[model samples]
Target: MIHRSISEYFSPYTLQKVEVDGKEGYVLIDREGYYKGPDEGIDIALKLLLAYGDAGIQKALDDENKSIHLENMGFDFQKTGRYVRHGKPVYKRGEFDLFKRVWSFHCGFCGKKVSIDVQPEYWYIVDQHGIRKSNTLSDRACSEICAKHIWDEYLELWLKNNRYSTELGK
Candidate 1:
């Protein structure tokens, strides 16, 4: 498993907060500016190593400073940041646009053609390989916004059915 010194684990880029149920939760992100140039190379290498173990993280550490220089050898991982392993899109248009985008999504479904939106403001993917609708599809701009209603409903139902499991996090 990946491990870090207490200081590295609690770095500013890492976010920590108490959940609604009072459990601590956190995540990391590659901080901006600090992740430029050589840091980019290190980031790629470290990610690959994360799959195996913290061997990469340890190797990246500096002999004198003892700091890994994550920005140089890996991501400036933060507990809070914008990137997500899997994120949807959110649109900025009016309700009419949302409906229109849905109509287009339906059309694509009916036509059996892939439709996709390239811009974050129009994400509307039906599936991993479905069309992109980041422009016309409000769901494509942001995944959470697109899936919030459905996800919330499903989660509510699941929680109700599985009352014994009483923990959740963001």
Candidate 2:
């Protein structure tokens, strides 16, 4: 049921719900007008948008006189995760709005979209791979139970890695 337009990301490419082999899925069209299918198509579209936005940011950074388009303004690489704001001009203004629209979805653990209006008291950022230090987006849990599950799983793996490192005396 997840569907979105690609006009904000780039030209021609669109992400829409479609029947793939009689099952519900998403589709992504390329700039060359080629059709790609399945959920991965949507994922690819997101990555493409990030890359394009990064390029624009780099361009503006390289030249003081140059300015990035309003749509590409607040897309930053230094800040990552479910939602991050460094409070810069481009970000402080309204750049993260576009990202929010694209990332508007349900909790990764329970598949329930966290209602912004409800303001649930229990919520957690699920760093499954312990890669929060890296430039990768982590999942958000809507409830404390889901959050605990995510943390426990991550901790188990982290402990195993620690044990192995200690055994190797590294």
Candidate 3:
């Protein structure tokens, strides 16, 4: 069993064993505070540690255990899933670890996480409707959905700045 402790989880909130797709699977703590690394800090440091997979993760966990009296580190997790705060059933997916797990880009417009084999590309953008739309350029590949999402987000910013604000009356 994969055992990990997130500074974000309840002391009792632990990993549970469950079958997924007829294979050995773990119920990752989908709760918030699942990760307690530095906030708004360099993501590379944290992700680099996690990229180690089983052996690497174990070492980190071991290191954390060694520092019980000092700084707490990764976790004692025997499972293979990352921490998610609250574990709510928003059915929301998260950024997968490319170092450890292979992933397909989820279209920004479509919201479909494609398999790496399907496109052999990098990340993607999803759509509001959760379907495949476009993909990032091969050299700089991202999904069309993500592209659109970014576009929409940009447009919203543009509109916000360009559009007249009624609150200006106040």
How does candidate 1 fare on TM-score?
0.20
Candidates sorted by lDDT, best first: 2, 3, 1
Off by over 4 Å in 2: 1-105, 117-122, 126-132, 135-137, 164-170
Please report how far candidate 3 places residue 101 from its true position, in Å: 2.6
Q: Residues 1-170, candidate 3, lDDT per residue (tens digit)? A: 23556763454233446687898744434346353333423454465466665566776665555445212222112331112112321123344455777745445455555665565454422221211133343212245345434544533443345442322212
Q: Model 2 over residues 1-170: C-alpha lDDT tens digits?
A: 11225665345566567897899976777777678765766677687687666746555443432223211322233343222223331111111243254443455467776554444333555233232333222244556666555544444454365332211111
On lDDT, the candidate that comes out on top is: 2
lDDT of 1 by residue, 130-160 (tens): 1122323323223334444433333344434
Give me candidate 2's TM-score against the actual structure. Answer: 0.28
TM-scores for all candidates: the values are: 0.20, 0.28, 0.22
Show the lowest summed lDDT stretch of 10 residues, model 2.
87-96
Best by the TM-score measure: 2
